[model samples]
Target chain A: MNPLLSARKVSFGYGAGDVLRDVSIDLHPGEVTILLGPNGSGKSTLIRILSGVLPSRAGEVLLCGRPPRGYPRREMARLLSVVGQDPPVDFPMTVESFVALGRFPHQGFFGETTPEDRERVRQALAETDLYGLRDRTLSTISAGERQRATVARAIAQGARVMLLDEPTAFLDIRHRVAFYEIVTRMKEACGIAALVASHDLSLCAEYGERIILLAEGTVASQGTPVEVLTPGNVQAAYGLAVSCDRNPATGAIRVTPLRGMPAKNR
Target chain B: MTPRARSEDGRLRPGPVFVLLGFALAASMALSASTGPVAIPPREFLDALLHGGAGTPARVLLSLRLPRAFLGLLVGGALATSGVAFQALLRNPLADPYILGVSGGAAVGALTVALFLSAGASPLLPLCAFFGAALSALAVFLLARRKSGVSPERLILMGVVVGAFLNAVIMLMVTLSPPGRIPGALYWLMGDLGLGTPRRVAVLLPYVAAGVVLLFLLSRGLDLLLLGEQAAFQTGLSVERVKTATYLTASLLAGSVVAVSGLIGFVGLIVPHGARALVGSGHRRLLPAAFLLGGAFLVLSDVIARTASPSGELPVGAVTALAGAPFFLYLLRRNGGKS
Candidate 1:
């Protein structure tokens, strides 16, 4: 079976410095693959490259079996959907209206949303449990609910691949766990090859089948959470000495980085 | 659950009917006039419009008030549509035709013509102003365009800088001019609609009509653009192309209006907000509503200006700013002091 997205030696940056350099990764079908990295470690940059928002400075990227740019923009959008971090929109759209915008790639410029498009939006709202608050203004929603509304929008895109950037960064502990559950359910039921960029090691441990660790604009490790979420690896990238233990209550691994004296500065 | 949710096609059938109503409003406003310095009866106004404005009253209407009224409609519609486009392209609520250096450039050009040279009723100043407005808009675009595309914030920042600098240049030109032309230059800066002629209208109408049509068609793209650049692009939009087309169309519309009307302020800045209040931000509704409501509002303003002072006609710009300023403050207060 072919991977849904492939990157090889891809590099990119702003004028300041390199954000992602010579990075290669693959996202496969029917799996929840989390791109785990510390903050400012090119996770969002890699997502932009694969999603074709930012041009690669060097090397190549492919969506499905061919060069990503070879796909028409609409075709690419039909193939992939993305939910970005910090969902700060300044429009007056209601939650339902904003979600309806995800169907842009699937509809003609003037074409009204068909029955199918409406149904997709309805399903996404139902899945995200936002059906009750669909009429509420997006500005009125809590940050966590807004985050899930964004996820619901991606689902409405009806794409095969889903790239999410910091999906739970602003969520409280409860919503974080709830979001992970939703992620796993989406992976099984929709079979979308998901690449979620996150800094939370616990969320990766609980929900991610595979974790790709990005550090200093390159991939530091790629494997199961047990292999990549080691204290040594985390300390190497984050410059922090950390201890890992299993939480008896939830049966999930937890990472605790030491504070004062910077814990020997890694 | 509202029983299967609202369907898209099942919405808003009364759209075209409203457009027709708007046309009737504009026509009635145009035909309904009073006996003043240039007295023309209402019946004669219609007769002149249908037949030829060859009779005394008809000729007076054709030559003066007719052009003035039509210029108000064209300028109002053009400015409002341009405002809508600018707000969408920049994704900023405060942007308007004047926000982008077009007005400053046109002011400079008109001042130069009024101060440095002597002219008859030849429409030379407005032509110069048109070129100046177009050039300033082009400068804004060029300064903002970088590697991938023009950033909205960069475009707006550049427009503000360019506009301020252009105003400085106009000030220098005026200061350096002969003292005799100072009053003329000052009058030119204040912006009056009397500079309009039927021929200027002929030139200005096509650009405004074409721009409004093109922009109305691209209304959906504009709506998508409010999502910011990356989101807009990821949703299958050709952001660069859309941005260029919209900027070109908007600048032309705004430029032509300023060329003829001489820096009419506040109409474009406020009309879109009013329309959005009535019709919502969906551009399909907002565009036409803005056009009609803007035209109606400006015509009424012009009438008030005509009737305001007994000694002489006040500048349309002064009148507009006065009428629109207090209303803008009220809006700000009413909307919880936003913008």
Candidate 2:
């Protein structure tokens, strides 16, 4: 099957520095692709490029076989939604109203909310377990709830592909697991594709069907977790010595960095 | 599941609040019309409204008081709407046209036409003011634009710096001008509504209406903007387009008003906050409520400006500052000065 989203030879940079370089990746339908990278490793930049928030300075990005720029903003929004890292909740809007913003792409500038729109928002709220707190202001919600609220917004957009940048950064362990489960269920139930950028190696190993490891704006490796999470690859990508092992109970890859390694070797 | 006393779609019920504000606005207009230098009774006011005449009371009611009151309403509404748009665009609650230096730019435009060109009485004043406001807005955008985007902090800083420099220029012009022109310039600078005429209102109404309608149409986009530019972009909003549209429309609104009624302060800053307090932060509700509440507040302020002294009129700007500055301080204290 054709990839839902694809990037070819994509390169992006700020003045005097590059953030992403000659990076190419594809996200297939109904699959979870985790982008693993350390800080300042171009993960967020790549996600922005894919989401059409930033134009790639070099190369091309296609959404469903068409250039992203070819689509109108509203039309593109309906096809791909992005949950940014730690979106600011400046205005004191209720959780329900905030989620309803997702329906923007589906409606006209002054379009009245139809029954279907309401139903979609309701389903999103329920899916993200935010229905119980629909009336509460976003400022009053916990950090995990806020993250879920943003996810619910993306889900309500009814997009074919979802790009999430460090969505679990503020989420606790329980919510982190819950978030991945929600994404997994979304893929199974709706055939939604997700490209999640994260630094949590274990969580990505647990949830990702495909992992793309990035280091300094380039793809270091791309394969299954067992293939990409090897000691040598991890050490090379992160510039640190690390031991890689499989968890016996869950049979998942686990990476433990050797903290006492010499600076040069690390 | 337990039933809640909310709308089925979770929309805030705004019917009662709108009706109440509408009534308050009508009542304020009536009160403003009835009491002025010459206090006309309600019966006479109604008679003057129904039957046009050339009598003194009829002229005052029809030609002067009625048009001035409506002008107040329009200017107030325009300022308030601009405030809402600017605040949303900048993602800062403290942002308003005057605070962002749009008004200062407009004042310079109007002052230049008035002092040097002697075009104050002509129809060119509003056009000049509009261009001035637009230029100032462009300057702010250019100064605030960074590699990433315009941050709220940088926008405010550039606005204040530019605004201060413009204010200095205005003061210099006032000092250098002929003494006879100083009073008029100072009064205009301080924001007087006495210049209101049916003709000026007719000229300005379309621009103000257009700005307000455009903002109302983009209310949904404005709501998305509250999530910050990045999230707004992800949500299908063209962030740059929306920001540009909002700034230009808001500047148009403020410039039109400033052309007619000099730099009236506080209506823009205070009305949006008041409206938000009444209705929730959703721009759909907030914009209309701000328009209404702002109209009422300005009419009342104009009333105070007319009647505050037995001898002469106070600048409406001064009256608004008297009331608005205290409330602004209180808001700052409440928000812990984060804005």
Candidate 3:
């Protein structure tokens, strides 16, 4: 019933400028939380803080009961995983080997691959539909396939929570939908909580159980999509004229931008 | 279970490749022992081995040729292993063992002992060279580090700067040294295995063993490091700790080898690429593959150095550079725009 991960008034800055200020968020088990914001709106920064990759300038982050940073890196990784924007392609690594890296936290420094580890990797590959391409090197794969590999890696981590930073940025429409479906399946099947940073408003409304809209390094709105995706909120946060309605088929909030309007704060 | 995770590691399958490389290494060692100035025919070589090795051919094989071949194996294996560690640490395939000025520092150390401290071949020369290499490597690491983290770009740049300064020092020492000191200093600089006695091989064995083992243990960590710093950290690798350990261990390997055999170039730079081609990039396999392949490559090069010209032996460094530079250029051309 309680939140699996929570950030309280987390603030972060670089040099003289602040990137995130007074942002608080929570992720519960088996929930799909969509984080929406324009570019440089502190979405990635917040994800980094929540994932313990960056220390918050102020406030705190708690994973389960303790601070995320208090745990050793591997222990923390056992509880949470992250999917970043891009996958590394500098070396020749098969997709299977790349995904198997997620098992590091579970394996000892000198440990051999256990049957369980291999099973997990195989399952992750199968779940992400990467089994066919597992033999191919990362350089030979498409960007969407690479993104899915990142997701597969997180899935293989077997973590309770996942934080994704623009995971669908390079995905085409079908893959974008498939990405959400995979996350949804993971949530339903494993009770894993996921926070996805995205710009796809309609998809977020359709798939995200909760939404946190950020603007100017602050949470402008946090609620169900129908409550937060209003015309006034979108216009204020994005400085664009837009209409908000419901998708007739899915009963999800639909946002449409009006053309030929002189936008403010452009 | 996804077809039981595929039994083989692609077409290369490290087990058989390891066996093949092991045989190649043994054959190269045999050829090296037999092909020196005193050519010991196979029959005589076997007779000496089976007998007490009292004959002249047996003495050359046991006392001179075998020790030098073993030295080549250790030196080549260490350099290639160090190269693998450095490449993983920097997350750059072009990174070599000497990229962080360890070799320059080593050269300075050997030159110092030759020009100022020792009158002749001193036992303390290798020790001094190692300390010099370690000190310069530490200096580069400290210079590159910031509060945020040690960025690979910053580390490489600092290495270049320190290496250049050390080179200047080496030049000044070589230029101003008494004429008698120059030959000893210069020969060491060029790199040779002529000094590979049983004692020298014994002295180097422990260092090479310890360094290679440590690197092998850190193989998984190194594998994660190729994911880049942030991703490696997120994946539960203590990225900074692993990088620091890799830097120190790799420096140790390069430094100790430099002390024993002088500065051997390109074995570190080229062997890992060849090994990677054979076994893919998994460090667990790649490290051993590189070590064996490097051993074979250097011993073969040394064989050519010993017999290529009738006049005298060429420095193995010269041979490696001659072959390695052309291969290096070809690699550069192939990888030009890809990176």
DockQ of each two-chain model: 0.37, 0.62, 0.71
**Considering summed lDDT, which 10 consecutive residues are worst modelled in model 1 chain B?**
B5-14
Is candidate 1 or 2 superior in lDDT?
Answer: 2
Best by the TM-score measure = 3
Residue pairs in collision within model 3: none
Better of 2 and 3 by TM-score: 3
Candidate 1 lDDT over B1-339, as tens digits, reads 455433232223436546764985566456424424777766887788799767888877777777777877888888888888888887766567776787888767666666666542335655666667778878887898898877556776788899889878987987887776645455446556675568867767777788899998888788777777788777777788888888777777776676566667778778888776555566777788888877777777777777789997777778878866776556545544432
Q: Write the per-residue lDDT of candidate 3 for residues B276-307, one digit (tens) a residue.
A: 87888889999999999999988988999889
User: Candidate 1: which stretches are off by over 4 Å?
Assistant: A15-17, A85-91, A241-262, B1-55, B107-131, B138-161, B168-188, B323-339
| Best model per lDDT | 3
The fraction of correct interface contacts reproduced by each prediction comes to: 0.33, 0.67, 0.72
Docking class of 2: medium
Candidates in order have lDDT scores of 0.76, 0.85, 0.86
Stretch of 10 with least lDDT, candidate 1 chain A: A85-94
